[model samples]
Target: YLKKIGRRGKIDIWLVDGAKIRRDLEKDFTNFAEYYYFPIIPKYEFWIDRESVPNERRFFIDHLLAEWRLMDGGMSYQRAKEIANQKELSERKKAGDLEKVINQKSEFSPEKVHRRLLDKTKDEIDIWLVDGRLVRSAFDIGFTEGGHDLVYQYVPKNEVWIDDDVFAKERPYVLLHELYERSLMKSGLTYLRAHRKASRLEWRARHSEQILDEFFLKFLIKKGKI
Candidate 1:
């Protein structure tokens, strides 16, 4: 079926269950411009491969730091530490051997790492220092966890610099939001708070429906009726 349609223009083929095909068809189809196969399913289903995951984290942290750096004109110690810890944990997980240590609770938990970040940045003042002189201080620097408890810090630095620490504590949602905001900012589009809230609510609604459906299926199985 795939080969019959490949004669026309350039075709990029993705073979999901190509192993089921006869060897003759496989040989004939190998002449395509490009072909890829999904041989082994990844252990971590929701995330990308270990090698690529750090890049994804770096992309998000860079965006966030760029924005915050512009606003405050420098980076905070807490944010820096948070980003570093996230990258470290990712590397440890990628090594595979650390999985046993992680399971045994010998490694740092994500929450504890984030808390440690808060502790480290608590006293630093966001100041732009140039040639041993304090230049500009951030007017407003705010850090919050989960909800609305605002913690403000003042830190002074020469220029906006992103260390390894700030890259590690970035959450997936934070990265996605930063990317979306950057795209919107580039396009000169303004995002409304109400619209953002509605979008999140809609996602939760669909997720709840899926969870309910799964639970109902489990109930039927428990009752021996499915």
Candidate 2:
């Protein structure tokens, strides 16, 4: 089986953003590392891989970046990271790794049920599990968003970035936090306040749901009917 799996089974550790991509594997791959992220053309800010950018649809990512004032260096730190990922993805497409591994359905696709929440958004949401180191570099967050939707509640576009280190039980909470917060933001709430409210509600539900699950499990153990 190992032979069949072959040497192509190398792990690709993804991160929340590009700038901190090296924070995790750099130490592990010190001697054997091959630096992939490089400065972009002209101004030469470093560019690196995203979790995975799907090419299933038309995109003017480059044009968007230019209009986004990304090249003028007027971009925010988060936007800078976003541009780097976009640049790296464009380069990857040129190298022919765009659709198969990066854009393949086997890698990412939207689902009706993520955990228990329904992503009723009009577009397909692409979800990615990124490296723990990458999550840490961004302040120990369990999840983040690359979503580019106009109305996050009513019609959010696809993108959900997750920390691979998040525990199985906690994963749903992380996803819930992101999704719920987006719904709030769509209602015109400020990010800071929306996040605060979302986290509180989600955290409460998290503990409450555990009790509900425990009751169900115990009842099932006693041969009680649902």
Candidate 3:
């Protein structure tokens, strides 16, 4: 469902709801933010996921607009994406939440030493901070900077992978999503199903208090373990 929420200059801002069709159709709509230009309709649109974190929505919008402006100005996608990414990261840092971690190596060597063992739930899940560039090069996945066992890649069968580029403050939110998704998958849910559930929980965590406690409580409620 794409609803026009507002307008910016000549572009239309839309809120996209993938909850209804995400699992079955797996439409290329599983995106936090995207921009589209319908020349036939003579319209320009920027679509943001309806469930995105309230705090980060503006960042996503800014990034998309920046990228679109550059692309519309004849810049290549690669160049535009890199420029937009850096700008977005800069804004996130200004928000005082983008804590960056430095990695010693440049290649795709999954470093377990820097891995974190999270005991948030009863399960002990390993989370490795990997190079986003390396991951993108090695795998043809569309993930911006996160992955789990759902895709057969680096790390063990039960580990989650986060981009080292992710800031310290935002890491927990990504970790929360990955861990919740893994838990649901382990409980016999399909990858898409689990992913959507995790995304919802991540949203809740960003807006509410005691995020970890809230996450566990909701999971338990879903499993009737409460």
Candidate 4:
């Protein structure tokens, strides 16, 4: 059941279960995601565990908060634990006010970590190429031993590292889409929220770039350059 819930600022939000597709159609979650240009939320599956929590009951965040795990001000589970370990954080939870954990001043901020890793300006682009062993290090958590394709760390404030999975020109297109969507982020939306909203626009950006490429090719052909 595909549905458009609403808009989170300038971006549109859609809801669908990547795992639950028509069994008879021979479709896959990754294919469905690529077909829609949406991100796959591994946390939803809880690692193959059966879960169907209602909207109201699905409070907090955890497991792996990558593309889809991104909430406006959500913190990583490890960061949460670091907070939980803090003497002051424990007091807040005892007072039934643990939500403040996100407000504290400390390191382990996944976004901040990513930002530092990027260490680039809005106009600058950084691409890292590492082996499979460093995949988990890049994420600090996620990225199991199995391996993964191109990963958009988040906003351009973060670096996009490509593993040894045969890097090519396609990476630039993905990077462009990420940068474009991040550019669309307005004053109110958080980086995470902005990404979920930019899903649709990302595809459009990619297609437009392709159109320009075709135009350039035609021009070159007319000049007999190719």
**Top candidate (TM-score):** 3
| Shift of residue 164 alpha carbon in model 2, Å | 0.5
lDDT of each: 0.26, 0.37, 0.58, 0.32
Model 1 — which ten-residue stretch has the worst lDDT?
128-137
Model 3 poorest 10 in a row by lDDT: 34-43
In model 2, where do residues sit more than 4 Å from their true spots? 1-123, 135-157, 210-226
Instruction: Supply the TM-score for candidate 1.
Output: 0.19
C-alpha RMSD for every candidate: 23.5, 13.3, 9.7, 15.1
Of the pair 2 and 3, which is ahead by TM-score? 3
For lDDT, the strongest prediction is: 3
Tell me model 4's lDDT, rounded to 2 decimals: 0.32
Q: Weakest 10 consecutive residues, lDDT, candidate 4?
A: 55-64
lDDT for predicted candidate 2 compared with the true structure: 0.37
- CA error at residue 187 for candidate 3, angstroms: 0.7
Off by over 4 Å in 4: 1-122, 141-158, 166-169, 184-188, 205-226
Evaluated at residue 45, the lDDT of candidate 4 is: 27
Off by over 4 Å in 1: 1-139, 143-170, 193-226
User: Between prediction 3 and prediction 4, which has the larger lDDT?
Assistant: 3
All candidates' TM-scores? 0.19, 0.33, 0.47, 0.31
lDDT of 1 by residue, 37-105 (tens): 212322111111121112333322332333333334344545653564455344434544233223245
Residue pairs that clash (backbone atoms under 3 angstroms), model 2: 125-158
Q: lDDT score, residue 150, model 2?
A: 35
Query: lDDT per residue, candidate 2, 47-134, as tens digits?
Result: 2224233231112233223323453455554665566555644544564432332224453222211222223223344444444333
